[model samples]
Target: MTVRTTARWALLGALALVVTACGGTSGSGGAAAASERQVQVSATFAQGGGGPAYTYDTALVPAGATVEVTSAAADGGTTTTLRVSGLQPNRTYGAHAHTKPCTPAAGADAGPHYQFRPDPVSPSVDPAFANPQNEIWLDVTTDASGAGEATSTVPWTFPPDRRAASVVLHEKATATHAGHAGTAGARPACVTVGF
Candidate 1:
């Protein structure tokens, strides 16, 4: 081949390699894997505050405590992680994604859990919709240093328009029983996360 023809072939080969490394543009699921969707938020808890984070009961979730949340979606699934510091030591706390943002007025303002399938009944005590597989449950246990982390992965992703708005930290671990499913103790702290 002539010099120009050989260079053209080399350039084409280079372009092909670039496309392959970038997962190609064929609208295939491979590209989706390469482009995992993720959202992260970090905030410090405060008492009587107006912010992305609030602590209704400063004893469990003390003022100045920090929380970092990460939500990632890929392969028809979603994983949520919660990390907290400066909380009460040697304690287990329950956390779940909520449908509304955290408000300073009340921890309950965060709304209900972000269920994969909505429950017809109010306060959804049914185990069908309140289970960890259907909801994001991140129960964390703090160490002596008052730091903890918990991660939860579900088999499905959130609908684009119906995503969770916040994560509420409860006073105790989640309960798993009919008539009391998904019930944790009082929500002491809440962190607003866009996921």
Candidate 2:
């Protein structure tokens, strides 16, 4: 592996350790509840086939790339953090929480963005339903080293009846225009994250 790749893995490992360390249950009032509100996952992109984390476009996402997701619900809201490495350098990737797990066939398998309030119409372009406040948007811009991170905090938590199951990375940054709000380009990669 290249030096950059090695360093990225090391960083991911450290982040995993930090998340684990902070996830311990205290067995006291509200302490265990607090720990239960957090979720963290780290996975390497599957190369030859589909897996928990898969790269649909090898040219952009590449094999062996790593994705780390951290979601925490507290203070009457939910905050999600997404970190990615070993992707194409100097590019912005649009990512959002999806309604289903990823599959080998197509990015569509991951389903639509997990909206706190379901949009009445399909392909929701209306800002009222597609805005960041209604859905988790994590658009990350990679640097020269092909590493990037993004965080999104929404005012509401994922309801028990419906929760996000994956994170889909798109080809470009998300569009916020009136007619194209929440529209990102083709999906290049996906990571199945339980949140």
Candidate 3:
């Protein structure tokens, strides 16, 4: 073969190798692994005697992904963010993820504190003695206009058999760091994260 022809063939072979390594130009034909999605949550609060009652627009979690709760409450309510990761799809995850449920009504119940009882145990025991790592807490604080932000990083996996589930924000305060229930209160607002 002529020198020019040989050079042309070599160039074509090199181009083919590059395309194969990069998964070709058609993006859809590449790997089927799940991609990460951005989820955002914003909230507002109603004025209370000492502070403000927490109210959230909604909570979001994408299917088959983990969300990093980056910023829940910040700057004394001027900014708040929460991050959550490793979430399960299509399941109804309680917002508090506490040992007990939060009070359903505003101003009347403190609801359940953020506690996860050890398996096969009693409520009388101190929450600290139980699984403290299981507790998920949200920062509660709002500006004069009752606006705030909450974020969580959640790693979630989608179930191929069913539609993905959602993350919900409650109206009440989650248990404080001290494990006090019935004070977290009620569900003022909520949001569902998807896709």
Candidate 4:
């Protein structure tokens, strides 16, 4: 081949190589971006209060988003799933996420509900005055071994300014709301939710 023709061909090859290296595609197609972050939590309850021993595992949907405690187990026990939605920020929600396989003690269920606190005051009591942000209420059930599952869609915003905290299960059952501290019962197991 002539020198000039050879040079032109080599340049064309080099240009093609560059284009391929730059991820030139045949059509307008690209990988999809990842969605919001998801957080998963796993908790195990030992033989506390001389009661049952069990393990619980659950997946929390978007980071800082509302979660519906979907499924759970107590020594392989199961229960009816509960739906608790729209969690509030700067407040504590009461939840009983586990309901079954059967702990050692008869009443040794997942104990009481969880209390996310510092919420607003109850409107029913003080008609005009507004209460502080308090806790989320959940509808949950358990099985024979005191194991169950609960889910909620949290409406609360996870504060960016403060440090991350956790949800704790108490040794005793809690009130519908976390009415009294130290009285909600002893903290059995705790699991951190956000980063």
- By lDDT, the best candidate is 1
Clashes of each: 0, 0, 56, 44
Model 3: per-residue lDDT, tens digit, 23-118? Answer: 654554432222323334322222222111222222422222222222222222211144433222232232433322222233213323323323
Weakest lDDT window of 10 consecutive positions for candidate 1: 21-30
What residue runs in model 1 are displaced by over 4 Å at the alpha carbon? 1-35
Worst 10 residues of 2 by lDDT: 23-32
Using TM-score, rank the candidates from best to worst.
1, 2, 3, 4
Task: Give per-residue CA lDDT, model 1, range 1-195, as digits (tens).
Answer: 699999999999999899886665565675776557899999999977667999999989989999999999987999999999999999999999999999998889999999989998989989999999999999999999999999999999988789899999999999999999999989999999999
Candidate 1: Cα lDDT at 16: 88
Give the range where candidate 4 is weakest over 10 consecutive residues by summed lDDT: 54-63
The C-alpha TM-scores of every prediction are 0.84, 0.82, 0.40, 0.35
Scored by Cα lDDT, where does model 1 land?
0.92
Candidate 3 segments exceeding 4 Å error: 1-5, 21-35, 41-136, 153-164, 167-171, 176-183
Per-residue lDDT of candidate 2, residues 126-185 (tens digit): 888998999999999999999999999999987787999999999999999887889999
Q: Weakest 10 consecutive residues, lDDT, candidate 3?
A: 71-80
Per residue, candidate 4 scores C-alpha lDDT tens digits across 122-169 of 322231211222232233344333334455443343333532233444
Error of 4 at 15 (Å): 15
Error of 4 at 2 (Å): 22
Measured by TM-score, the strongest candidate is 1
